[model samples]
Target: MKKLYIDYDLFLRPAEKDQPHCSYVLRPGNDGPACLREEISFLFACRRCEDYPCVNSCPNGALKREAGLIKRSGFLCISCKTCSIACPFGIILPELLPYLAGRCDRCIGRLKSGEVPLCVSSCKNGAFRYVEEDDLKGCPDIYPMGDSIIVKVFNWLGSYGIKK
Candidate 1:
C-alpha cells in the first residue's frame, strides 16, 4: 500500500526561526521560498481517485495505472496537454513540459530495495515522513493557471521554461 507523509520541520520561515517543536500533520511553510513551494504543493497532492480523468484524457496512452499507482510513459506521450486539461485538480502540471513530464513513480527502485525514496533519504532536515492517503482527501487536482499555461508560457518565455 502507498502512503504519504508530511515534513513539518521545513515549515518555518527564516524570520520565524523558532521551530514550533512538534510533529504536525498540517501546517503552512514559513517564509522560505523552497519551503513555501513545497508546503503549497504538499497542500495539494495527488488524489489517486478511482476515476482518473488524467489517464482517460491521455490520447497517447502515456499515462496508465500499475500496482495501484499512476505511471507515465514519456516516450509514448505527445505532450498535447489533454491529460492536464482532463485532470480536475490540475495537479498533473504537464502544460509546458514534455509529454509524461509530470508523472511521479514513487521511487519504485528504492522501494524495491527495501530503502526509502531518494527524496525522503536525502532530506537532511528530517522533515520527510509518510502518512495515510485518507488524510489528504478532497484535494483539488487542477492548477489555477488553467489548461494551456504550459504551452502558452513556454511560447511567451521562448526557451526559458518553468521547472518542476
Candidate 2:
C-alpha cells in the first residue's frame, strides 16, 4: 500500500508561494487531521535529561526510555497532552500522539481509486506525497513513522549547534 510522506524541512519553512494549507476541513475544535499530518515526534532526538520529564509526566506510565529512545505505549497512552507540555525542548507534539491523533484516512476512497489526498494536492511546495514503499529507499532523511506514514527530517535548526 502507498504511504504518506511529508518533507518536514519544507513544512517548517515559510511558504513563498502561498500560505501552507490543507483543503481537508477538520471539524471545529477537532485537530485530529492536523496532528495526523505532523506525526513525526518519534524522530525527534531524545534529550538525555537528568530526569525525564516527559516519561515522568505520563500519569499511566505510558512512556519510557529504552536504548536511548523514548518509547511510547500505545495501549497505555491516553492522549493527555501532559507529556507534550512537559517536554523541555518542545519535541513532543501532542497532535501526533496515538489514541489522541485523528485519522487522516489518506482520502481513502479516492486513494484506492489511484488519486492523491486533498492535503497532498493542496501543498504547493510538494511537501506531501503518497508514494510506494520502494520509493523511500536511499532517502536518508525520510523515516517511517508507522506502517503507512513516513516523514522527512532535514535542515532542522534544533540539532544545529549540538556537537557529537
Candidate 3:
C-alpha cells in the first residue's frame, strides 16, 4: 500500500503558519486530485477507537465518519460549537471557513489558483508536496529539491501552452 508522509514537527514551526500542514494526495490524469479516502479513513478509525475525544465532544452534529471519510457539513456547522476544543487535531480550522470551506477545499483552491497552498507556499525549505500514489513507489523520501516545484514547473510549462 502507498503511504503519505508528513513531518509533523515541521508543521509546528511558527514560520509555516500560512502553509497547509499536510501533503495532498496527487491524482492521475483528469481523475481529479488524489482522493483523500485513505487519510479520511485513518481519521475515522481513530475516532472509532475513541483515542480522541472529538467524536463524542462535537456539540454540533457537523462532525461524523462516513464512507471512510471524516466528513463535515459546513452549512450544518453552527460555529457556536467548539469541535476543535475536543479534538485539537487542527484538521478542522473552524475559524478559516469564510475563506476556506474545509481542509480539502483549501488545497483544491490552491491548485486552481495556479499557486501552491499556504503550507506548500510558506515552506522556506522544500519540505512539503503532493505525490501520486503510483509515483511514490519510485520517488525519494526527501522533500522535492526546492519549494514550489509544482507551481514553478506548471507555470513554466504553461508558457508553452502545456496545461497541467
Candidate 4:
C-alpha cells in the first residue's frame, strides 16, 4: 500500500482555479503561490506579519500568532473563510482550513477496497497519486508535508521565464 501524494503547480493562477473540483478531500485547493515568488503563498513557512491581519479578521478568534507564525484552533474554526480574504498574503486558503476538527480519515474505506484515495481519483488535473514512501524525495517545488501528503508548489512568476 503506497502513501498518497499531491503535486500541483497552478496556485498562482486564480482564474484557472474556477474548475469543477470543490472538495478538500480531492486536493489542497488554491491557497495562492508557493515558493520562489514575490507575492505567492507559503507552505514551508508563514510570512509572520508584524500586525497579523489574518488574526484580527477572525471573528471567532480561532487564529492567533505564536512564535511569529499564525496558528488556527481546529475546534474554534467556523469555516467562515473570512480569514482567507483577510490574509494579506492570501495563504489562508479553504483547503488549509478544516471543515471540522483536524481529523481526516483520508478515505480509509476507499483505500481498503483497493481503490485510490478520493483526491487521487477525482483530481481532474491529475495532481494526486499513490507512491512508495521512498519517492518522497522532492524537488525545490516539492514539499513533503507529513501524514502521507506531498506538496509540489510552483513558482508562478518563474513559470513565465521572467527575469527578476
Question: How big is the positional error of residue 101 in model 2, measured in Å on the Cα after superposition?
Answer: 5.9
Worst-scoring 10-residue span by lDDT in model 4: 31-40
Residue 129's lDDT in candidate 3: 47
lDDT of 3 at 84: 55
**Model 3 misplacement above 4 A:** 1-8, 14-47, 50-53, 67-69, 88-100, 103-122, 130-164
Query: Which is the leading candidate under lDDT?
Result: 2
**lDDT score, candidate 1, position 41:** 32
In model 4, which regions exceed 4 Å deviation? 11-42, 66-69, 94-103, 136-138, 154-164
Better of 1 and 2 by lDDT: 2
Ranking by lDDT: 2, 4, 1, 3
Query: Native-vs-model 4 lDDT?
Result: 0.56
Please list the C-alpha lDDT of all candidates, in the order they appear: 0.44, 0.65, 0.40, 0.56
Candidate 1: worst-modelled 10 consecutive residues by lDDT: 148-157
lDDT score at residue 13, model 3, on the 0-100 scale: 41
Better of 2 and 4 by TM-score: 4
lDDT of 4 by residue, 3-120 (tens): 7665554433334543323223433542212112211243343456678888899999898776555667867989898988987766776656655443344557777778766555
Candidate 3 lDDT for residue 93: 45
